[model samples]
Target: METLITDIKIALGDNDDFFIKRDYLIEEEVVFLGLNTLLDITKTKTTLQKQTESLILKGKTTQLLFNLIGDVFENDTKRAISSILEGKLIIFIENTKQFIIYEPISKSINRSIEIPTNENVIQGPLNSFTEDIDTNIGLLRKQLISKQLIVHTTSTGMVQKTNVSLLYLNDKVDQKLVDNIKSLIEKNNDLEITDLQGLSKMLEFSSWDTISKFNTTELPFHASQFLKRGRVILFVNQLPFALILPNLIWDMFIVENDRNFPFPIMIAIRFLRIIGILVALIAPGLYVALVAVNPEVLQIELALSVAQSREGVPYPALVEVIIMLIVLELIIEASVRLPKSVGQTITMVGGIILGQAVVEAKLVSNLLIIILAATTIANSTLVGTQSTTSIRLFKYINIILSSLYGVLGLVTGIVLICSYFASLTTFGKSYLYLNIERKDNSG
Candidate 1:
């Protein structure tokens, strides 16, 4: 018993919350050990100790313990330590050198379900996925409500075990896709997955890849909708969002809840997202190309007006664009990281006052400010934030190319982007990927 207790202490070295309590079960000295922070020690452990004492009188120590607890790990100190950390009550019978490990009352560790702060709800379910994977799966199952919704749970991580679940509709999901995803995970079992980026690495995606291989949504409604459409949704423990794999080009322009509107309205909404993406990608580069390289393309009167707006700007068109773009990027990043109430104030001050100040000070042209504001607003229209990253980064390439070769370079950059999307693969599913119908006997 002393050896086991010392082993546990050694395993969790110097953790102040770890504790061991000595008590007697009717004159038989017993030891209870666990993390005090995680275990319910005040009332629940006391009641449990009383029950163990009563059970001991009725039968032999080992026999009664095996009967009462039904989970006894003998001499496996590693397993014992893991159990203790997981909030299980550990009782050791000192004289016999025997130990029984069973679950105790664990303090409430998970937060309640709250509305998604990331994904805005249009006309769908309000509650979103929480940090608890089981609760998230439960939320999904409540909406899916079908036996065909298969949840395959697996444990991953190198030193510690983390539970991950893959949810897909058995009747609609492709068998090949499921097998491929499962095989990729099983083959990389040794790879530690602490976050989504780690999982991306485990999947062997290039770090330099511009577009994310998956799309994320905090909304359970969107998750369920994706599952119904024959897509796999990955849920990592403690991650409060669902990752929809092989995120396609169309996902950026499409919102599942847009179906709530009439057919014409839905089409119009998707069209607007497409238009927004185009404006975001083209505006900054077009500003540079027109003013610096292709001023002759504009009408005579328009060219004169553009020249007038840029008159006081000391820097060339490219430099002026770069300066304003950097300021805009800083403002955008600050607004996201700050607290919501503070973020709004920062946005107003940085966006309105700072923008007007720069134009008046002639540090950047007024036309450049209008172009950047439009780019920032248009960037937000993309469906997923991860999807927006590609545009945000690639737009710089467009700006550089446009500044050099005018409209020709911008066209080349756009073509390269199209080719990049075309070359992406999500478990062998490319930009043109779609779900294969499940065979009737498959499920």
Candidate 2:
């Protein structure tokens, strides 16, 4: 027993937080090992005393003690050390190389469940996921009360061992998809995944790819909806959001709030969102293409007006577009990094001042400003922030292509983008496939 204690001390080193409490259980001496900062020492001691007293009354035997404890592990030093590090109270019985591990009352500092700040909805559940994995799973279970909803949890990260949960509907989801995901996770068990982004990078195997193959949401109801639609949801330990796999092209225009409205209204709103996405992606590029290469496509009056707007501008259309795009992007990034109230003020002030000043200074044309303003507003209608960012980035491709080949270049860029989307796959599922059909019996 003394040797075991010495080994534990050596493994933990001289860390100030490491602690050991020695107690007597009848004729045997029991030692408790844990971290002072992590364990609720008072509750742990009380429970230990009560359990030991009861075991003594029943039978003072090693087999009886093991049966009472229910978590006995035979002499494994490494496992004992790991359990202690994870805040579990490790019990060492004298003369018998056995350990019992259990969790005691400790400070669980987790954010209170509150309304989602970013993914707000008018007619759905308001509560969002908190940082606690148990709380998040409880919220999901409350919303999706079904026996088919399976949650498989495992710990990743060799050093930290962060908890990861894979949630899916057993009856609806394809078994092949589940196997693929589990295989990927098991293969990367050595990775140190601290957040959703890190886990996503590990799963996707690329950090440079701007497109997200998963739909991330903080709302449990949203996650439940996706699970019913044959999608798998992944939850990380400390992340407040859940990731839905096999992100489809249709996901870009989906708005969860639209479901609250009437059927016709929902359809119209979704159709308009699709139009908004298209306009956001191609409006600036089309404007530049028409002015630079295909002015004949415009009516005489509009063409003359556009020409008049550019009369005093010094830079060419392409350079002017690039400059305005950069300024707009900078304003956006600044607003996001600033406080909420300050961000709103800065965005409004920056947009108004910069737009007016640049046009008056002849750096850019008035028509271009209007086109860019419309484009920016339309870009916000995309479902997820990631999709919006990807669209914003891809717009530049269209702008450059239009500058090179006018309208034809814009067409080519759009075609290439569609091709890219079509070619992309997540967990062997095509990005373009919506997975609306029922799975086969084999699935």
Q: Which candidate has the top score in TM-score? A: 2
**Residue 211 in candidate 2 has what lDDT?**
83
Writing each residue's lDDT as its tens digit, candidate 1 over 278-380 gives: 9998999998999999999999999999999998889988788888888877887888899997898978786899888888998888888889989988988
Model 2, residue 271: distance off in Å is 1.2
* TM-score to true structure, per model: 0.90, 0.92
Candidate 2 accuracy as TM-score: 0.92
RMSD of each: 3.0, 2.6
Query: How many backbone clashes can be found in candidate 1?
Result: 0
| Every candidate's lDDT | 0.83, 0.85
Worst 10 residues of 1 by lDDT: 434-443
What lDDT score is found at residue 432 in candidate 2?
A: 88
Off by over 4 Å in 1: 24-30, 46-70, 93-98, 432-443
> lDDT tens string, model 2, 1-443?
57777889998968999988888655567787898788788887787678778887876685677557647887688888888887888878877887777777665556899999778688988999988888999999999999999999988888888888999999889888899889988988878889656887668556666788778898998889889888898888888888888788888888676899999999998998899889988998998899998899999999999999999888879998999999989988998899997888988997899899988998899999999989998998778888899999999999999999999999998999989888888877787886543556672
Error of 1 at 345 (Å): 0.5
